[model samples]
Target: MSTQTSRLSPEKVWLGITPTLWWNDDFINIDIGIPFEQCISEMALAGYVGCSVGHKYPTDRKTLKAALDLRGLRVSEPWVSTYFTIAAMRKQTIQKVRQQLAFLQEMEGGSEDPRKADLVVAEFGHAVNPLPVALFPNCPNLTDGQWDQLLDGLHDIGRIAKEEGRRLCYHPHLGTGVMAAEAIDRLMENTETSLVHLLLDTGHLAAAGVDPLAVTKRYASRIKHIHLKDIRADVVARIHADGLSFESAIEAGIFTVPGDGSITTFPQILTELAEVGFAGWLVIEAEQAPAKANPLQYAKMARAYLRETLGW
Candidate 1:
């Protein structure tokens, strides 16, 4: 196993900002209104060392490299935010995973920009309500067959990533079937670490009622990337009371920037990452009400908080 260097210096933990922060229109959010090159330049101007390329953004190597070169920014990770039905065991779902792996492989090999050659992130385990009956009456959960399929699929993708000199980071998102701490443990245990890794999102962990800091300490060896977000517990309560869907709750402003919400344990989490020698990009990802706060301004504040409280 390749080990991360000991003690990531302050400079090593690159503070990155996703472009979605500034763009409000979901349709054009990933495709910034400005030219791709100009959009990247703006990100760099905002003091972000890197920008995560979402699947919605340009995935073509030529275009991606041009933008990175113009902005002097690195592609921290390719955020493949697709919903993979780990438990459905559907042929189409399995095919989508294959397609994603192929895309990642192409990006890894085609990009002349070395920074763009990092791992492709894949998320698993979301159980949206109005659930399918395969696992639940209205939600989707992994059946035994689906579980085996998911494991086999991940092993194949992991091997592909390793061959291409890339990595695959499995993201455990809240609202996903694998949201709980135990679920996360099971997912990790079932997969080969050499084939896939973890992308720990602190906000999701906390919102799911797990101690994010504890998970970080326990799985420090597997975490390759981190998404820094915070949530409001009151909002969470309201969502539960109203039986609001995750999408509806987000529309109602349940989530917020890392420091603007009730995630008081973040500083300790950051300290833990430091102790574990985790030197990677810390991306600020807020998918809340964009109109409530200016994204750029929010990012500025988030960066300031990270530096002040987290000693980043």
Candidate 2:
């Protein structure tokens, strides 16, 4: 994952970490029994000053702020899953989004703050990521009708989020209906730019067999958030050939922190960001088992790599 690139200023490219490294919510057995305090403290010690909300964190503003502020960390974003393939889930999704937006807005404590976090969402429509291997190859692709439903719902939700003084960044995650490059193209082509934005994740893009920097160039204007991750490309290939579930692939160590993986395009991605004057959270999100890779050590390694490469 080594790359040689020019650096962006510290203020322009804020570094953050996702708590998935410390305590994975999807597969509890892999969490290594790390407490919330320990996780945040370790992140601070590892040189990260911001993070996205995870399952272990408090949802309430005051309690959450107190814990994070104590550790010199601020919230960057939060993931929200939306099942937009059906009509019934649409109302529930919006209601939930409104609640989330309200919480983030309240945290900002003003009409609009540049530091306010965007709401990151992934379409959880018939996602077969954690299911058995049989379901992985058979993962549902969005039908024309479903695409209509999704794009309309996204436009509505994204517009409303904007009206509420927040941004909505769509995350095209693996095992979802919109993981492929063609699907992402359709999404960007259909969705309103003023509302829906992109959350470009490096590892997910590579795992999906898509070139991450190409996506960055194609959708530079719409990218509102970034998730800098790395992939063991060989492991990813084997997972696809063997028909492994996302969970199984993760457990097999298919992902890792940047500078510890095979992603050589990392520097090019950073150069693209620098060229665009992009200024947002560069979240280090490597969803790997903590039992094998100590979260604190991995976090420190990533921090040191970024500092050396970006000269922050």
The best candidate by TM-score is: 2
Residue 276 lDDT (model 1): 69
Which runs in model 1 stand beyond 4 Å of their true positions?
1-7, 23-42, 55-60, 81-117, 120-126, 129-139, 310-312
Report per-prediction Cα RMSD to one decimal. 5.1, 2.2
Candidate 1 local lDDT, 91-123, one digit each (tens): 554465567556556545565543433454444
C-alpha TM-scores of all predictions? 0.79, 0.94
**What TM-score quantifies how close candidate 1 is to the native fold?**
0.79
lDDT score at residue 39, model 1, on the 0-100 scale:
48
- How much lDDT does each candidate structure score? 0.65, 0.84
lDDT of 2 by residue, 72-168 (tens): 8878887789988965898899888988887776666673435668889988978888576543486779899999999998999998889976789
The candidate that achieves the highest lDDT relative to the unseen native structure? 2
Q: Candidate 2: how many backbone clashes?
A: 0
